[model samples]
Target: MITTHAAIEDNIKRYKRGELIVPSDFRGKGTENAIKKTLSRLAADGTIKRLGHGLYVLPKKDPLFGEILPSTEEIAIALAKKEKVKIKPAGAFALHKLGLTLQVPTKLVYLTDGNGRIIKVGKNTIRFKSTTPKKMALKGELSGLIILALEELGTDQIDESTKLKLSNLLEKENPIILKQDLKLASAAVHDFILKLILNK
Candidate 1:
């Protein structure tokens, strides 16, 4: 039988490296229950945080701000991979990527076609939205991100400068693969992207 303290130490070491582990990770040699108990104790001690269900992460500390660290989207991606689900940044994440917004979003939104759930890490929330993989793949990063930004910005937000920047970036990135689908996009999305490309 693995000792509770030893298991807790080992778990903390693994979590420090950005690994998310559950009781199953300790499944061998009849250590599952002991490991779960140890994990709960550690969580109560603030050595790690519970991210919902059986998910947990080692909290990172920010030196400059003297506070707990911000949520790492990479961790979210890794979690999705562990759950065998495909995910892409959406909403505020997409907005930030488009250079249209500078706010640090507290909620990490991901587009996925799989089951959706809300995960709480420390004081922040990470939300997964169930969306078709095609929609997730569409907008194709830069263009998609720009589209999301425009959606948040509304119709009048598609100014000449925003169009020029978006066009240049799209031309450089070349999201032509998304064009056919873009034709069927919302009127604002289709018109804005097409006009930017044509005008240039």
Candidate 2:
């Protein structure tokens, strides 16, 4: 007879390295306690790495980086997919995603329609902050991220080079979607984006 731990270990072998694993993935294979215990054991044995509470991944080894782990953004997006919720990059993370910032933040923040929580993965932290529906309803792919970054920086912090960078970034966005997203922006952001669009 296959032991519960053995069965789980075999199942984990089928997953690609770096794929996200959650308890729900093994729902019918064993009891909740059995699965959790087996997963903990796997993590302890270096077969898989525990990311946050209830999150695990099969470890991937890179020649230069040693053990390659998923980025914080990837983990948050995976969690949102599992929970069937929506998430939007916010604050410093938004800036970093837009290439407006050179340094990666130790704490990544996202706006979500679901419950807010914090999860620490190694030295970095992922924060999901509950936000209003309106903020989550942004239309453009790039425009929404730009709005978040600008809001975090505020109007006073924006400078000539920053505006130039934003204008260049805005060039790649769909004009219709960009215009639609501008309506959702704050007064300052709306005006700023409008000027960029017009100047384009």
lDDT of candidates 1 onward, in order: 0.68, 0.87
- What would the per-residue lDDT of candidate 1 be over residues 76-180, giving only the tens digit for each residue? 887787778887676667766677568868887877878999887656678888876556666566767666555545657556765676778778655565575
Q: Evaluated with lDDT, which candidate comes out highest? A: 2
Q: Residue pairs in steric clash, candidate 1? A: 139-144
Model 2 residue pairs with clashes: none
Q: Which stretches of candidate 1 lie over 4 Å from their true place?
A: 1-16, 21-37, 45-55, 59-70, 148-161, 178-188
| C-alpha TM-score for every candidate | 0.69, 0.83
TM-score of predicted model 1?
0.69
Writing each residue's lDDT as its tens digit, candidate 2 over 73-177 gives 788898889888999998878878889889999999989999999988888898989988878999777889999778766767778887888899999989888
